[model samples]
Target: MIPLQRISVSTRTQTLLTRWTKHVQDTGATTKAARAQWKKAKAPKAKVRTALESMARGAVRCMYCDDNRATDIDHFEPLDEAPLRAFVWLNHLLACSYCNSNVKRSQYPVDADGACLLVDPTAEDPADHLELLLKSGRYTAVSGSAKGEETIRVFALNRPDLVKGRMDAFSRACSNMRDWHQLCQEADPEADRVAQALLDSPFIDVVHAMTRLKPSVAAVVVGPRTVPALDAWRSAHGF
Candidate 1:
C-alpha cells in the first residue's frame, strides 16, 4: 500500500465534530442519537461532506481488490466492539466497498507474540509483506510469518478474478510502455506531447501497473516525483 497524507477538516466541520464528540462522551448516547447529532449539528451538509472528502485525500488503494472508485470510511476495529474508536480518525480508513464488504469487515486482528497480522495500509507498506506474482497475479507472502499469511487471507489476494484482473492490467501497461518507448525513439521534438498522450490514454490500469514495475519510467512520463498523485490518478480513473 502507498503512504497517505492526513487531510485537515474545515473549521466549521471541526467545530461540529468536536461538539458531537463531546455529546457522545458526556451523555453515552445511543448510536442513533450520535449519528443524528452529527447530522443535525451541521447546516447545508455540504461542509461536512467536503470535510469527509478532505479526509479521504491521498489514501491508498483498497487492501483487497481493485475497484478503486470513491472510498468509504471504514473502521479498523468494528464499531460494535470498539465503540470508543468508532469516530476516532486514526482508526478510520478510506477504502473501496468491495474490499470493505468481501474480505475485511469486522475481522479482528490476530496476535502472534507482539505482532499483529492484519495489514494497516495507513501505517505500513504492504510491499514489505506482500509481493505480486506476475504469472498468476496473486499476492504471495515472501516472509514466512503469520502476519504475511493473515494479510493474504484477509484480503483474498489469491482470488481468481482479482488475479486475472491484475494480470490483464499489467499486460496492458507493458504494451503502453513499449509504445511510449517507440514514440520516444522517433527523434521528434514532440516527445513530451507523446508522453502526455499516453497519460491521457484509457488504459491507466496498465500505467499504474507499469509504474510499479519501473518507477523511473513513471517519473519521466508523469513528471511528478510523487507516488500519491499517480495513485490518485489511477484510482480516480479506475486504472
Candidate 2:
C-alpha cells in the first residue's frame, strides 16, 4: 500500500460536507437521505472525481486487484453499517466500481481486533500481509487470520481476470526495463536521451517494479533518493 497524499478539500466542498454531516447527526437520517444529501451537496461527485484522478495520476493501483482504472469511492469501513465514518476523509478511497459493489458489499469489521485485516492504502503497506502468486496471479494473505482471509475473499483478489491483468502489467513493465537496459548497453548512448525516453513513455507498473528491484534505477531514471519520495510519486501517480 502506498501512502496517499491527502488533497485538501476546497472550502466549498468542506462546507457542503460539514452541513451534510450535521444534518445526519441531527436527524439520524436514513441511508437514502444521507445519500441524497451527498448528491445534493455535490460533494460526493467532486470527491469521487478527485479520488479517481489521483489514482490515475499515481500508480496507486487497486487495493484488491492491481487494476489501474479505479473510478469509485470505497469506504474502508462499509458506509451503510458505519455511517458515522461516511464523511471521514481517511475512510474514503478510490476503487474500481466492481470491487466496491460486487465483492465488498456490507462486509465490515466483526470485532475490534478483526478490524486489522482491512487494507488501508494510505496507512498500511499491502506487501506486509498480502503477496502476489507469481504463477496464478492471485493474491493471498500470508498471515492466516480471519481478517486476512476475509479481506482476500471479500476483495476477490483471486479473480482470474484481475490476476491476469496484474501479471500482464508486470510482464510489460519488465520487458520495458529490459529493453531500456539493452539500449543503454549500446556504444555510449546519450544518458540524457535515455532518461528523456523513459520520462516520455511512463508506464505505472513498470516504474513501480523497477523501483522495487533497484533503487538505483529509480535514482538514475526518476531521481528519487529516498523511499518517501518514491512513495510520493507512486501514491500520486502509479507508473
Candidate 3:
C-alpha cells in the first residue's frame, strides 16, 4: 500500500457527513446507529464512496490490497472503537469488498503501548514499514515495524494469487521499461504513451520497487542485462 492524499469532498457533502456524525452522537453513539447512518450515506447518497474513490490509487484500486477495484469505504479505525469518527473523512479508506469485509473485518490490533499497529496509508508511507520482495511477490516487515507485519497479516498481502499478480507485473514492467528506454533513445512520439501505460499498470508498488532498486538489492526479479534498462527507465521517468 502506498501513501494516499485525501482530497476534499464537495462542501455540501462534507456538511452532510458532519451532520450525520452529530446525528449518530445524538443517538448514544452506538455501533448499530453508526452502521444505520453509514448505510444510508453509502447506499443511496454515495457521496462518501465517490469521494473515497477519488482519493484511491490508480484505477481506483483498494488502498489496502492495491489489487482489486475499490468499492467500499473502510473505516481504518473500526466503528466499534471510535464510534464518533464514523463519518469523519480522515478515517475513511477506499477498499475492495474482499479486503474491507472478508480480510480485515473488525480486527484492529494495538501494541502494548496502546498505539495502533495497522499502517494508515493516508497517514504514513508503507515503504517505511514494509519492504516488497519483487521476485517472490512477498512483503517483509521493515525492522522495528509491527504495523507492517500486522498489515500484511490483516490484508493477507502475500496471498498466492496476489503474489502471482505482483510477480507478473514485474516481468511486464521490465518489458515496458526496455520499450520505454528504446523509445527515449530514439525520441519516439509514443514514449509518452508508454510512460503513461506504466503509470497505469497494476501492482504499481512493483514498479515503485524497481525504481528504488540500488546496488544493495541482491535479489531482484530482473537479471544483470536489464540493469541498464532499469537505470535508463529511472532516468527517463526522473526517479
lDDT agreement with native, every candidate: 0.55, 0.57, 0.82
Question: TM-score: which is higher, 1 or 2?
Answer: 2
Error of 1 at 67 (Å): 3.0
Per lDDT, the best of the predicted structures is 3
TM-score of 2: 0.70
Ranking of models by lDDT? 3, 2, 1
lDDT of 1 by residue, 129-177 (tens): 7666554566778677666678778767677777777677655555544
The sequence of per-residue lDDT tens digits that candidate 2 reaches over residues 9-117 is 6677666666667776765766665665555756556765675456443344554454645767776776576665566666777777788888877677575755446
User: How big is the positional error of residue 145 in model 2, measured in Å on the Cα after superposition?
Assistant: 4.9
- Among these predictions, the greatest TM-score belongs to 3
> What TM-score goes with each of the models?
0.65, 0.70, 0.91
lDDT of 3 by residue, 1-239 (tens): 77777787778887888889998888889898888777776532488777777777678888887788888888988998888788988888888899999989988999999899998988888889999988898988999888899999999999888899999998998888888878878989898899888877677778877888775662345777677778777776633
